[model samples]
Target: MRPPYFIPADRTIDYQLRYFQAKQLHQAVVIDNNSRAVGLITLEDILEELVGAIQDEHDFA
Candidate 1:
């Protein structure tokens, strides 16, 4: 497996989005101030946060 990309958790969503696009990364590991793996972030998550929730057929009630 490829090594995961790590990004600072303090970064803005816009910065992270650009970084992801530049590297063609779908997901990344979030690093906290202590350099610990604190969470995971995905391209979809960034888009959704920027544009609000996205709905698809799978979201049907």
Candidate 2:
């Protein structure tokens, strides 16, 4: 995978959504500063993560 497609750890969720949508990438690889393959971040992965986060917040509330 292209390194430029890798997202920074600090990027906002909205930014990620737009980036992926504009790039037309269904998935991306998560890399560290050392340029190592940390994990995979797909569209489904982000969506699930977002959903889980929202549910967690709701549960806490």
User: Highest TM-score, which number?
Assistant: 1
lDDT of 1 by residue, 1-61 (tens): 8789999999999999999999999999999999999999989889999999888786875
lDDT of 2: 0.73
TM-score per candidate: 0.86, 0.60
- In model 1, residue pairs whose N, Cα or C atoms come closer than 3 Å (at least 3 residues apart or on different chains), thus clashing, are none
In candidate 2, which residue ranges exceed 4 Å CA deviation? 1-4, 52-61
lDDT of each: 0.94, 0.73
What TM-score number comes out for model 2?
Answer: 0.60
Please provide the root mean square deviation of candidate 1 (C-alpha atoms, Å): 1.6
